[model samples]
Target chain A: MHNAHNAKSILHKISRAFLILIAFTATFTAMILSPMLSVNVNAYTEKKVYDYGDLLTDREESRIEEQLRKASENCGHDIIVYTVKSLGGNSVSEYSQRAADGINTDSDGSGILYLVSINDREYDIYAFGEMYERIMSDRELNRLADDLRSYLSEGDYYGAFSEFGKRVEKAALNNEDYSGNISVRLTLSFSTLIVSAFIALIIVFCMKQGMKTTRPEITAGNYVKNGSFKVTVSRDVYLYTSVSRVRIQSNNNGHRSGGGHHSGGRSSGGHHSGGHRSGGHSRGRF
Target chain B: MTTSFKCACCGADLRYSPGSGSLKCEYCGTEFEAEAVEAMAEAAESDAAGENINWQHANPQTMENDGSTCTYSCSSCGAQITGDRTLAASFCPYCGNTVVMSDRLEGMLRPDYIIPFKVEKDAAVAKFKEFCKGKPLLPSGFLSSGRIDSVEGLYVPYWLFDAGVKGRVRFRAERVHTRREGDYNVTRTQHFMLYREGVMDFEHVPVDGTSKLGAEVTEAVEPFDMHGAAPFAKAYLSGFLADRYDVPQETCRPRADERIRQSITSALANTCRGYTGVRPQQQFISVANGKIAYALLPMWLMTVNYNGKSYTFAMNGQTGKFVGELPISWAKFWGFFAGITAALTVILTLLMNYFG
Candidate 1:
């Protein structure tokens, strides 16, 4: 009976060890196959570049596709170029954010989207997730927009997209050298003028007030009519209400804003100055 | 002619002490009510009214050999005093005594109201000293060279005008409201037409008319408590000198009118309330009728010649409000400008570098 009990205990220990081995093998196998499954799904589904506006010719599309794919792979970021014939009654911002959500289905929202609305003549650079904050400074972005959009305006679509890819990649990688650029100089000069003017006014006012002994009362608030303030004629006529709109040119294409009522389309390209400043200093170190 | 107020309790001399709002004996520190002193005196109150302005022509003076042109003696110290046409006994420069040289002043034009000195000479000196303290650019010698010793109290002549006015004012005002609709921020500004018509009664708007006193000094010393003015008494002039009006009432009337017109227009414009901005488009003020009275307001005036430049400073003998022009140092101004500008710019640059 003692021999039989010891044998039974040993068999039970062997079975437990074999079960542990099987569980480990199954986890390892799933880990190995999961990435392959996602890659295959993404290969068939995810779009790297989009030419919805149909502005690019087939050869131009292929070239842009090649540049964007390299930039995206090199930076570990989903860099994309999307164009649409119209915003489809949606703001460029809404469309771009949606496009970013669609294109980055398999990844975290860490990428930049260059979206163009052809008929609106507007283009926006929208950065998502952590990479959004790491993008170039607004001043630097202004410089970029001001510099590269000339090619876009002249209809050199390939040249413009190509230049945009290189510069955006250069900034995202924190390798830009703006120390010799005129943007930095313009910033310092303009800041000095504005700050100097304000300080000069304060000093001038203090000196003037110091020298001046008397300022006659501006208003006879002392002798205001009885009962403080009384308005017997309280009529605010509904004089026809007119609405005026200003078409903002967010792309820096030298398009002057015209006064007219607009449809529901608003450009989502707000100022990127606050984030761009950090991007610029990152630029400085490199 | 010189007049003096003596303290009833101490039998010592009394001068109008500004801070106490009474005639105060400097030696015994006893205060006496100004109106009480005026009433106890023998001369009866003559109901001095605004219509009591009497104009006179002046006689030309000859320069004296001793540099004492017009002879006016200090009644208390027996010192010889001389000044221009408005010359009254200032303190005896030698004895440091307050003496009112009261001759030919009352006969020319008796002031209907006197806002006696509510601020003392020491207070005026203190105010002047305070004004000189912060001005590092001022020539050091200007303060140490007894420049402030020239400050003295005098009753400046002003004509008080009372009037009932009819004011009609028109204003253009705007009210703006903004709303966000889809992509557009719609701003609607409503323009308004406002009119105000009313009657306002203004009392005791004093306009200085003394030829010896500049408008610069007098206006700076303004806003005396006209309500505190006791009826003018010669007894109040006992230890203090008063300036007789050198400019006629008619000449001063235009200034008073201008002041009242501005005041009424502002008052009426303010009555059109509840607008983002209200601007006076048109104003019409008509004085239904006005009354004018000659009065004396207190002021301490000093004009110092420092570095061959005259710098004028005045203190309100009623309110201790000090006003003066100080010498400017361009070097100091630029030094501060450079330092502050550089400091602020550095801070701004660092902030922009971090989060521009």
Candidate 2:
């Protein structure tokens, strides 16, 4: 009576073990690959410097200009010139110590600029237009411009930005930093990473909370019907609902099996916003 | 003379299907009328029905304390039967067998249906063995086959109540408004009715009939296959011991009713959407058709004595689903606790450095 070959149970155990193993391996792979990916990104960036792209709104651009004027007036840099370029694709926000002049219209004696700010940071800038384009790649030009503005902010405008421009001029003289001048592409890549990370985290958190299960209630008749679960953006901000049924019937004979079935549906609705707009809604029922 | 009935077409045994309302043959697909079988089986029931006497007077055995120090009393014999929190009562302790005593069952609300045991005793044992095999904290000697005493067939008391439940709730929802001052938008609420029909089915829910065990203890031994339960039969009690519930039948009705009400009301709140806050103003649930029964089911019971503690295990006799107490190996427990703490601490420290 002790013979033990139960195919169903054996299969169930094996499947569960396989699932757990897969889960652990996937988690481990993600952790190990993250740092490697970051390193690869940093290396690629060092070889080919880029721009911040055209993700910033017109309002953001103006905000950066306003901040720069306040910094120049209050910080006593005596800002001789202020030129904030839309850059179309290569927007800079932060600055360091370097080029104080010979940027964005030196002919008019109004080229020594200070800052170009955005949603994330402020960048130092210098622009030498068509006259310098033959010598500088767009990528190098953006970097030089940012560094020049940064140099002025740190009060070392002559050393950093001046040295950067000198290096560009040398590269032009020798002809080397021109082939990899993808300033526009680099800006797009950086912007894409930031936006994607934000969106992914929001979606993950929503799905996790939405499907969370609660403890079931046990009844007097030995029946354990599942309890209610809520899907919400926040507590009481219900997005969807679902219900399940547990049925028990009388056993006419001592040789029958008694079990229940599960079936249900859910619906969810929420707001999706793009640009500077809000109040558009989408609802899904399934 | 013994008379046997088989399908005329395939010579297969026929079974009655409720949904079909007829006796269908497993082989070659034949159907038979229950009315015809009823007349033929009448003689068989007369003899077997002898055991279906008054439940109160049946299985009257005397109070004999089991040798085990921690026994709960047997419902039939009034015999002292020892059990711990983890031990599901299956058999009378003194009898050393799996038999359901008359006292531990409902008087008439017993299950009329059950799913027969598909997994045998050995398979159930194997399942338990696999569960314990690689658990680092489990002791090697704990699962030696010699320690397993026996399995019991018992009919536990349960309540099956049905009712329609409804509730009204009021809530607040918020929306935002923007003004062109410096920049950003301001938010506000637009309240609305989040009403829904949240209906769910109620089944063989277990409300413990006896107060001998706490509610928590019973809950821990979850997930019985009521689907495999058989009709009430003292013959099923032949190989096992059973207990009569000490608590009165009426005493357990209110508790079962309470669980139904809670599930229904909570379901209502769950359906509503886009509300800031919702409070249950009015709620109602009525237990319609209050019926009860007594039946004998199956369980495999085991007890182990370790370091001055008695641990128990119960396996569903019909389905081979197992539940039991774990003998905590203090050394392994400490090791697991320390390892988890250290790993989590390291991860937290790394996160702090990266984000800080």
Candidate 3:
């Protein structure tokens, strides 16, 4: 009966909440659609770059898919590709430098790939993919791939590539040490230290409280002749004259009546018990 | 405080009968041998023998009853009847004790301690009478017969154990804060600790030691005074039939432990509240059995016959603490049941219309 009642109440509450939600949504829709709610429009521009590659060439599509898939998997990102026809051997360097200029980069000879990016690290892989493998030797490219794979697996893709770049620069700089970035490592280590300290402090405090209190014992005895709730034997008997009365006469007659033991001792301790001040139990505000 | 040379065979108001060198029952015309009587007198000194005496394997003895003993029976009765030596027997207030058989005396463990009956036979009868008067639902003829079954005095055996209990409790407490608009994330983490070294003292934890009786029967008569218990003697069991310990000490210890642990858990909980980041972290308790003593207490038990059912009543001999059930009137029971159902329906309907 109780379970049924609870279930009914639960259903009622859910339906009531749903009704309230619908009512709220209706009011919000009316307010949002009102003429007084002005739409904010900002100036924007769009340019479409059309592709006219061979539509039925399987080999060409497969090759492009392979490149995009490799970039996506290695960098933990999603990469989309659209086929383009040849433009009289327009070199990647020419287009990259032009894009870099549009973004106001100071380096004239440096190439900067412009790609719509969902994540910074993944976008870095796209630019690295177009250049590093093609420009560098097989041994160096394999080494960089291994490093990037490990970094992405550990959720530190950007950090790993940044360190790789710094290492290459250092090697070129005649073995000079250059600390490119250390913020992420320092932040992680410091947070771990703080968490450990808090746990240790709580444990110590509980132990102290437990050791401090030593109140005199209070024992709540058990019910002896329980269940006499309805029936029990009620009659007095004596062993000699009657069969019911039982008498307990003290005995010093037995040889093995093991004598009782009695001892008393006092110890020193400041034990606070019963109801202590809740005042001491506050987490200080920083 | 009192002296008496009463007949051991038949309890009769005795006066010194001439020509008889020993005690004699005047009504039954039975004589006790002088030497045997003297030995019986020495039995008082033998009480010390009862201090640690074991009655586990003692032979069962049958108690004698006369034609006065009548057993009543009823179809709806659930009570068992034992006969008393009396010419007048009332309807088995529970089931008219219909079975007329020889009364039996079973001996098992001798009680080590006992609380003597402070309420006399007359007082007990008066209490029962008074009890019946208030039970208006009972049939009017039930108590009018005025037949008082021999209110044979009895010493019921009990075991008392003392111990110390220690426990460790583990709990989790969480405090939540929200910065509603920007970041509505709930930061909840479990904090663990070793809640060690809490101790409790347990006393008079009772474990029923009679194998013949069920635990339900024992629990029905709870809360005997353990502090006032005196050492046991066979003399206290006179005139009443008693059962010895068919159930052993070790066997009953677990029941006591279970009760004590349940009690301690609650006691520990009372202190567990009122902490900000405090919840039960861990919990464990150990109970060590301490001094164990046997006790026998006084009780006035009666079975009653009502409508078609039998109800029982127990009056504590020492403190007059009464516990037991009285048969409920069918009319009143159905009336209350219907009334409650109707009330619940009305309340639920109103709540559903207004709030649901």
Candidate 4:
């Protein structure tokens, strides 16, 4: 009976140790699996500039894709240029938000997508990921749009796309000198001068009016008997407050780390923010 | 201390001294208070009345007639001076001017009221410089102290009109309220109509009674103190050039009526306050029982010719309000514009560089 009891005890101890080893192995495997999964985070979408609407010729499209590929590799962030015949009845915001959710980045990082809708006559620029504010500020995006204004208006699609790629590359690099846009700088400088001159001219006109001291008295205020001024009629009526609301516009050019810095700042859980992460703003024709 | 303004000690011309507020001899500097002069004047009038004297209003023949009124001619300045025969001006009071007035007094009707010059010549000279002080383009030494001090005092003829005015006006007003809710802002306004009615009494509104002195130049010197007015006395014209009405009261009536209408309308508008927009929708001001009188108000006139164009400066005798035109310097104007533009450009460029 003693020999049988020792065998039972030894078997029980071996089973408990076996369960403990299994739990330890599973925890260790998960730690390694998490990092390995991060490696595939950006593998879902390698096509940086998708011409799904076939807006460009095959050769032009290939050339743009090559440039975007270089830009993406150099900037360490995805750069996308998309064109669509229709927005599938979605507003630009809604459509771009959906597209951003569907496309995941290589490193699960920040990215910018410029889209053109041929039928809707509308274009939108969206910045996605945790570093949306860092990727490009609203003012920078507006400036980028302005640079494309002439090309878009003239229907020079290839020129506009090429310029867009160059500007995005420059912005991603955070170039400090020349800003790659002398025309915009020159226009802003010249307008400032014109507006300042107009304001100065108005000041001079007011000064001239001051020199002209003689003015016809318009009110009887001076002549009214001191204690005699009476309103005689006072009535106020209530009117309904009609409300109108518009989406908030951002003009803050806040400090951003562009694209790569936010990876460490973000959570490792990596389920995507609310399943619709976006801090992008846009201006459109339609 | 005769009926006329004459030197009691040296037989020199005695004029009212503004600094001492007395009549002083120009030659001997003998001072006599205005009260003493008033007393002597009354005594002289009583003496004349006791003799049962009667004076006629007519042009004196040859100006040598020893009558109540006579004329003096300045061969140097060509000025025609008309005053009491006993008060023969020692020097042309309107003299020292290169430009002379030589017209003869055909039949001068005496003025009913005269405002003695309250501000002295020295004070007027200082005020004139104050007017030119801020004009950047004014030529240096153009209006020297000596030149401005020589400005001659003149009894300017004016038609004083008195009237009772009634004005009625209508105004549209608004009250505004603003409210904010969520991302929306709303402004609401209430409209109202207001009526104002008032009656005001305007004692003395003056119209220039001289053709030689244009209306614009004469009206520039305004608001003479009628309170200090003494009866028009020929003795008061000792050191000043006095004129009679060249333009009739009938001709100056319309101007007085227009001023009265404007004054009442403005006066009524003041009573309708606390409105968002108190605009005069309609105004009807009428002058009633208007009385017009001929009077002489004191003024100082100075004309300086520069670059073939003459600029006239008029100063109110009582208030010393100076009015004149400022000559613009093209060089200064263009320089100011360029300087401002360049400075603003530099600042803007620096700001853009720092901000960009």
List the candidate 3 regions with Cα displacement exceeding 4 Å: A1-286, B1-108, B121-153, B169-194, B211-217, B275-284, B289-291, B305-309, B336-356
Report the TM-score of candidate 3, chain A only.
0.23
Q: Estimate each model's TM-score.
A: 0.48, 0.37, 0.35, 0.48
- Candidate 4: misplaced stretches above 4 Å? A1-180, A195-286, B1-98, B101-103, B139-150, B172-193, B212-217, B351-356
Over B235-324, each residue of candidate 4 has an lDDT whose tens digit, in order, gives 676666666565676776766656665666566666656657666555555555656666778887666644434566677887787766
Predicted candidate 3 versus true structure: per-residue lDDT over A145-203, tens digit per residue = 45555555565423443444443333322311111213443343344335534554454
Candidate 4 docking classification: incorrect
Please, what are the lDDT tens digits per residue for candidate 2 over residues A1-286? 1223334444554565455545644554455345434411100001111113332345544444444344323321212222233423433321211222212212222112333333333444332222133333445545555555445456442344235434443444354322243343344334443454455445434433322111234533345345522222222322212122333444567865643111111111232121111111111110
The models' CA-based lDDT, in order, is 0.58, 0.39, 0.41, 0.58
| Residue-wise C-alpha lDDT for candidate 1, range B224-257, written one tens digit per residue | 7667788866555544444556678788776766
Off by over 4 Å in 1: A1-208, A218-286, B1-108, B139-141, B176-190, B211-216, B307-309, B343-356
lDDT of 2 by residue, B1-356 (tens): 33344443354654433334345557755444544344223323332433111111112223343322233454544544323323455555323334232223222332343334344567656655554555555544456635553543344444333333232222323333333333323233332223333434456555555453445434445556666556554334333344445555466556655665565556666565544465553344433344444333445555455444555555556556565555645443443443333334335434643674
- Positional deviation of A23 in candidate 4, in angstroms? 85
Docking class of 1: incorrect
For residue B42, give model 2's deviation from the true position in Å. 58
Q: Ranking by lDDT, best first?
A: 4, 1, 3, 2
Q: For model 3 chain A, give the 10-residue run with minimal summed lDDT.
A: A277-286
Looking at model 4 chain B, report the run of 10 residues with the lowest lDDT sum.
B51-60
CAPRI band for model 2:
incorrect
**Candidate 1's residue-wise lDDT over A1-286, tens digit each?**
8557545654664465455545543553354334433421122124556998988999989988888887766555667788888888876666776676666654434566777778887776666543443454445555766676777788777787788788877776663332233356456645754695578558755754675574444333343334534333333222122345544334657767873222222333544322221111111100
